[model samples]
Target: MTSDSRTLQIPEHQQDGAAQKSCYQKLSDEHVEELELYRKNGLHPVHLGDVLNNRYEVLHKLGHGTSATVWLCFDTQTSAWKAIKIIGASHSSDDRPELKFQLQLSRSDLVALPTDHFWLVGPNGRHVCLVMPPLGPSVSSKHQTMDLEALREVSMQAADGLAYMHRKGICHGDFRTGNLLFRLDSARINDLSKGDMLALIGEVTKIVVETDFGEEPGSISPRYLVHSLNTDIFADFITCQIAVIGLSLAFEITKPPKTSSVDLPYASPQLLLRLPPSTHSDVWALGCTLLEMQTGSVFGTAPFEIMQSMELLLGPLPKPLQRTWSRVYPEEMLHPEGNTEYLTWRSDVISEIKKHTRNADCLLKELAMSRKQSLKGLLAADDKNKPGSIVWQVPEKQVTQIGDLIKQTLSYDLHTRHTADAVVQHVWFDQARIHRKPRV
Candidate 1:
């Protein structure tokens, strides 16, 4: 269960206590000391400029999250760069359906996995490390900027990856921007020379610093250089990865939807309320993410904010979810303006909601009320859809296409949501348009 307990092929004479202590020192970075107190399937600590088995040399600490510390490592043996994710024991049982799914396909059919895992003996103990091809910053990183064209490309590629996985019966449990990284070539950076775009990718690709902090013995943080990457490339790639993360979850392509925990803001209503996660749920999350990219803010400021936002803009939940919501916060159901579907108590719409959710039909009687809207009132001051508002700033043609595409994916009615394959075929992305070609 602990990496330290795992066997290492080091010779006994060389693996003395003092040597082991020294090795541990060499393997540490900013968070390594805290990470050294390893948890099961959790994060293992890492230091900057460390070397593993004299093969993979840690160049710089890239990033760290709850699960692992990622490093930009230089592979001495292959004379190339790679990403090394040093992880602990907690996720030992995390089912990576993609691995099995990939085996069934030819190399050409598969996109990259987050990382290809392996084990390495370190100063503290043995660690499970994932070795991946080197890449640049996260698309969600603060520096990223996206235009309409870039977003479309991102959506298309993401759909492609998800469609491949969905067809093989897998769901990406966690689909978010941080997990998606990109590598932009010199040619792409050149595209940025057009405007302030150059600033988004930063000044250069490589930088040699003593450490993320300052100078020390193991202080050499070797970052590589290629060309300054463009922000658009990062955005496009991230959108693609978001799709991949959704497909990575557990679900049979041909079966009913399943359920799992997800981030609060991006979580589908069903996921938030403990309902089964289906292809539709992923669509909902995608809608929220895309919206965030467009507006630079989440739909809600808090739990109540989300509920209020959904009721106002997206509509007052599918009948089943509404029924569940009404029970917990019965007060929320009493809308003075009659915001339950444009003041029309359409039995047919209720029937459809019921038909889609066979279980919900049994939970509540037909929802009958004059449809009124709370969202129009809340956002009345600056309706995002209006002409004078920021949303309207997007080119007219693009606004309709992008909004329609995202809305279709965010359809509150699960049945109305777009599937990954359907998303790929969307006219918004399929429509003909001029594209900038990179020489590289």
Candidate 2:
């Protein structure tokens, strides 16, 4: 790709919306409603033959979300491919202006933001159209699978990216697995060229979709690429997509809000409880996202279900949540009238499970001890009734270390939670660190 280094101001205005509207002006507003339906229900408003901003040609629809419909397009000026996010919301106020912020960020390692963004008024109204280098696939895209090492790399980089955003006072209020991108360049560590990486990807995902996100900047890969040479180049090929790609940021990336519907599965207890949002909440999102990237599921279906899962997987609610439980959660939410499991906590449970560790913070430790004792006792009682039943075991040491960090990320108390900066250095990422240390 050539360097169109023309001082990098935003692109000039696109082809006039009026000019484009003339062809369809004969159609009644009722007919236009049908056109609107094109994008509303997973159809492309612009045909493949159409051009955007007179500079971008619509290639195909990559994906769509609540706010905008994304199109893979060709940038005539830069002669590169870009993803165009056309905001569906009529007002421009809802769009994120961080494309400029992304271009100016101090860290070059972050490939999660687009190369550039600009606006275009459309037939509907003024739309804050974001033009950025394509983000390859949603981290949740069905075509890919990653092993543990690949996942670790993705987690560490994600944490580092979140740290960079938080330090800059930018809350990527909607950071989740789906928003993350995987860019594919040639796997240099594997000694594979760009062509090889492409071939590897085809073998991995098992189906060929459009693979181009952007060219890798140089022969040297980023720090996130330092994993043990994975055997399945196909998986890591998709994995390294994260290693060598540029990303885009669109809307709602402002100061952390009290709450937004966008933050699901990863929303912190504080935010869920209608408390003030903070940068630390982003840290919580990073943690929750890493867990889902591994587990491949949302935290739960509803708030109550999520709370139960978290309490079981991590420890109980921190003291703050406990204190407000009555005020915030109704009896139905805490213990649905028909669900006996919620009411079974008493002396019987205290005898079965033991405290996991004595090293947790005082509040966490006490809660952990109590919850575990109850859980263990209940399990023992069930076993006594059944005689010999299948046994359950705790996660191994390394896994427990990682689980502990995840719990810290999911901590109800911000004080007990792990910061994005610290999470990158956690023991869970130790193996990846060892590989990078020698080279650094």
Candidate 3:
């Protein structure tokens, strides 16, 4: 489908007028998918009690993406829990590349694949429903609480999964920590009753969808929108294995898609330069993911900001792309003299320290003031205003090794960049393998 068709547009009759204003209702809650998208070729409306394929019974909403809504369902035939991803009518097709790639890798242990797929004839059109084994929350959502050792394991496993895919001539166009999910123990979850499952994952939260007018949603929209559940309650049951998912953008190395979407922060320099997606680009993305795991934050959020940060840290763009970069971004927007955001963050930290030291002895207050001055001096350094230039709190030795690996993978020249297989064999991962501990 063309991009224009997927754009949300309210009917012309409901554009302006008392009747038009009465046609729509605003939802106050946050994190819910846009209601305007629940029309025509957008989302396929699935209710809480709806039984799909006469086997999978909908239990609760897991989450929703731009083109699909995922649900937790009970499999009557298999007597197990499964996740069903219902793709929107516009994106769903029997010959879609995502489905084809999924079926090709169904037997691989490195990725999560649909066990079965069927079509649902909705009011809009046919929606492709994929049944999969339920997994835990993404690694990015839970990485903050994990210790260094746990982070190492996740990094190693993720790199290995990427290497496995690259070897099969596949490129995961959108490779990032958010696409890596922790594996859940299916044996334990399968034995739980519906009531027990609810107790474990918490009750489902929903709010009714009401229009200003009295028009019924019927098949066009869901009766109520379900809030996505947090899977932190199952943290203890998360296994060491991590599954690489979100294959909608994945494609064969021989044939790159005409267009693709990727998270800005994790997007490789090649992708940002409008170069074709390749296995090398995947390696660059993996580098960004590894750095995020170690730092607990992304390097930068905006495209220009990320580009500036990359230049500051990884040196200038390759000679071949320097002219392209200059053309794409104006010189005025390239780099600013100082970062107000960074200064504000430092100021807040200093204020907190002073507030805590107010009740301390004179020597303690003096020490706090000395520390504040030291921070100020650090900020005065040449690279202080650069994004992601803060000093890492990890041990010096560990930081050096991790930084070396990341630099190798994030090389400006794709020819010089490390491949996924080479990344898995890096010295840092070798050390990680030697010191890896079992997750409790």
Candidate 4:
């Protein structure tokens, strides 16, 4: 077949939602010539078992989104399995302002973002097909739930990946459970047995040793030695940290909090309001995703519902929120003092969850303890703020400093937020021996 080129119409706004859906819809009406080019260049139609790019032999369809269809494929050359996500673009697109702009921007800046982070895996080419690691079935596919420690390990890796991206001034735009993958046995470095329901329950639960809270200060904890053995997180941390050394990107000012339901509960408040996401956004999503992993839920709310809910519960915005919002969202009309109210609402929600749900309550207790220890260093630093109040719950002798850093990484404000690189320098990462050179 001869090379054919065509462009299909894609709405400007929809480009950021889902790439798979965008590709399929954009290509559905494209000219025959463009279709010919796709077939000739290796990105054939969404047919089962058809090989694309002569390298990836489609084995089965994995999942599909607006812009693309992901297929489980085998590499003819490597004799290894891979994920191929086809984002079909045409040569004759008449309209697609948002998509065009994003594509143009991605093309210019995308390469700048380091792709070597193992946890941040994706395809190597951009012509149309997005390559990725071969993913096992969903977490639920193996068992109803995973070990909390395993999930934490996975999250730590994801954090490393996000830190790398943030350092490079890149935002994932969409961060969700669906985007993560569990490596297969053949892909694993060690001969460790594959996970199953039994493994989920039987795997040793990791205990924390190094205390972030000052309450545990001067305490020697053996549990701190149980940091994750997951390789992806380490690789991501190393590579991303190197790549994101210097890049300036626009960051949004948080507006005052109006009492609205979370639009994308998993997305950071900044990103939810269309602000440029930063390391803090990644931390926020990580926190939300951790909640999702515990509860098995996705996060979102319709605009109308959000507004109605916020108005009913919050009553009215506080002054500080109004000032913050005015600076963040000048064009959008928002409740004058919404940000402060929103934070209160958030605290209330967490408190309510702790009171109501056993699982959430337990987690909140653990996290709260962790949070207290995280600020241990600053506790004495701000004795003026502490007056007579005790800064920590656990005795200072037993507290771990790592707990404190983790808490700050998840701080609410964007400006006061610590960079991912900064987080890696914490005692936890250091004690984990993540960056230490192996003895020759």
Q: After superposition, which runs of candidate 3 have C-alpha atoms over 4 Å from their true positions?
A: 1-30, 330-393, 434-440
lDDT by residue (30-141, candidate 3, tens digit) is 5467666666776888887799999999988888887999999999898899999999899998766557877567556678888889999887678999888888989887
lDDT of 2 by residue, 63-162 (tens): 5543556665666675565668766534344335455455445365464455555666543445666765554555655312455566677777778777
Please give the CA lDDT of all the candidate structures. Answer: 0.48, 0.51, 0.72, 0.39
Maximum-TM-score candidate: 3
lDDT of 1 by residue, 1-440 (tens): 00122111222322223332222213223332232223323344344446865677764555555455667566676655566766544543334444445453323322455446667654334556666554555545431244445656665655665566566665655555544445544234334321333234344333222222433212111122122223333444332222232223455646545557667677776776667766667667666766555544455644455665555445457667767755644443335444554321246544544345422122111110000122223346564542221211345455566656666777777777888788777776664223523212
TM-score each candidate: 0.61, 0.63, 0.79, 0.45
Top candidate (lDDT): 3
> In model 1, which regions exceed 4 Å deviation?
1-41, 93-98, 104-111, 121-126, 142-144, 185-259, 328-392, 432-440
Task: TM-score for candidate 3, please give it.
Answer: 0.79
lDDT of 4 by residue, 244-294 (tens): 111112222232123222226555545545555544665666555544553
Off by over 4 Å in 2: 1-44, 89-95, 103-106, 109-111, 142-144, 186-255, 333-397, 436-440
| Candidate 4 lDDT (Cα, 0 to 1) | 0.39
The Cα error of candidate 2 at residue 192, in Å, is 18
Better of 2 and 4 by lDDT: 2
- Candidate 3 residue pairs in backbone clash: none
